[model samples]
Target: MTPRIHGGGDHLGVARWDFSSNANGCGPCPLVLRAVQEADPSHYPDPSYAALRSALAGLHGVEPARVLLAASASECIQRLTAWRWRAGDRRFWTPTYAYGDYAHAAAAWGLVRVKEPGLAQLAWLCDPGSPLGQGESPDAVRTLLNQTPRTVVLDRAYTPLRLKGDSALSAEQTDRVWQLWSPNKALGLTGVRAAYALAPLGAQPDVQTLESLAASWPIGAHGEAMLRAWTQPEVQGWVAASRATLTQWTQALSDMLVGRGWAWAPSEAAHGCAKPPHALDATALRARGIKLRDAASFGLPGWWRLSAQRPEALTALDTALNGLALEVAR
Candidate 1:
């Protein structure tokens, strides 16, 4: 198996000006933080997650039976892949650039990677996709959804973090594919580790099978609290309000980088990719308490993925780049 590459909080410890992970810069929402902190760890979450599932379903206006719980988004990816593979799915498709876990899980199941969506029994889609924050044309999404006997999972992890633009799939179209959501990123509490998926209409059997495959109590106390808090109206409001601040910060970061000769890849989401005028020395940047995600793993070797951060963090990044430039000049 290929080694997984990721950003944020590495062995070197968290960077002071980390532009790697795409967690909401304006959060750890106060509501979520309080919920997670006050969570009673003395007991395990209900093994079936009955209350949590119902709450999430109510939020999306779906039946509670359509909600499937997972320990995290990655867990859902792997579980969904395994569930389909067991049912004789031997081919999988992924976007040209996508979260590594999608492809990673498929590969582990010995599935062939099909270049075209029509040829695969299992497919993954991430809207406002990772690394680039771009999505397939709505027509393309419709085409994928229209295919029969294909297990299509649409990862909606970044939907809440979108600074602008709407999803490529409509509500009815979205209901046709499995919708995987991990709100910890939106709540800015990624460490909490909880996620759930809304199964396609009439996919209760698939949901049950996936649940049976899961370990009991996949979510613990804190994760349960965070997920429950995620369904609250106030928490949703907090996420909506953060997007405005994120937009301004994203624009500022783009302007600063472009002025310094970096070429920004237009993105509608909070994170984006850019290529430096010259090669980037990641090691040198980290030395100055800065970290950026190299886009090489996402098939863009010359670019880096950066998230919108607070102004102070942006200033620190600016200072770090200047230092690197001075050293290069010397």
Candidate 2:
């Protein structure tokens, strides 16, 4: 069976105002863009990726040996599941509504879904999780850790984009789980796919297993440049500044939606789900070059996940909703 497609972006060509994907609205960071453009594609990157790995490790204050790079977060998900299956894992669990790939990868590798976290061999957790943007509860994390699952992976793709709240896990607690990092979303360079994970401390054997399963040169020149840019202080500073802008935009968009009778789901991230006052024709909005993610796929029906965009884009969305309201009244 084919893997299911997940998330939203400019997949159907490009929308004039796209709120489907939760990428940083204020990026691609200028520094990251420059680095990608200057990256030389003529030569292959050092297969060992020593310098790049060290840079990332230094940024996170983790040992370079614990870092496992992949083509993207989705690829890492599949590869990790594959390795776990080979090691006799036969059940997977996701504590909350998750990215589709989590289930897809598990099923593809012959793992069945288990509702009870303690019974599962592999568990997936996303903080400031997608479609909803809420952080995982600390008590819940503690419970999961106490359960002692065979493997647990925490997807931190949205952590950097979180507009509010801290992670539920303490640093020491974080070291006990696989922390996956996908810098492209945070940098607004999603087109250049590259992601890395910091394996749990003392999981060197599992790290080695993952390394063997990986195809050499999993990341390309542009991806390497993007990941490299992610390690720079100035680039992170840019990301920090962008959050301020995103905060303002998020509030403005939420207010507009609320005023129009849409019910908003509270979120700590720059993106969130909101229910329209009435049903909306998604295709009609697409025709006008606007896109909003339907949340049914993420298990939230009657809602759409909208990313905060610039004021002009918000105005365009407001106008589109007004049109829909008018047609419904007619």
Top-scoring candidate (TM-score) = 1
lDDT, candidate 1, 129-210, per-residue tens: 8999887667667667774768888999999998778889888889889999999988888888999999999999888899
Model 1 steric clash pairs: none
lDDT at 154, model 1: 90
Ten-residue region with minimum lDDT total, candidate 1: 135-144
Give me the candidate number with maximum lDDT: 1
lDDT by residue for model 2 over 1-330, one digit each (tens)?
434645456557868898887888898789999999999999999998999999999999989999999999999999999999999999988866678889989989999998777777888889988878888877667767884757889999998889999888888889999999998888988889899999999987888889999999999999999999999999999998999999999999899989988999999999999998777799889887789988887788889999888889998998987787688779
Candidate lDDT (C-alpha), each? 0.90, 0.88
TM-score of candidate 1 to 2 decimals: 0.98
RMSD of each: 0.9, 1.5
Q: Which stretches of candidate 2 lie over 4 Å from their true place?
A: 1-3, 9-11, 147-149
TM-score (C-alpha, index-matched) for candidate 2: 0.96
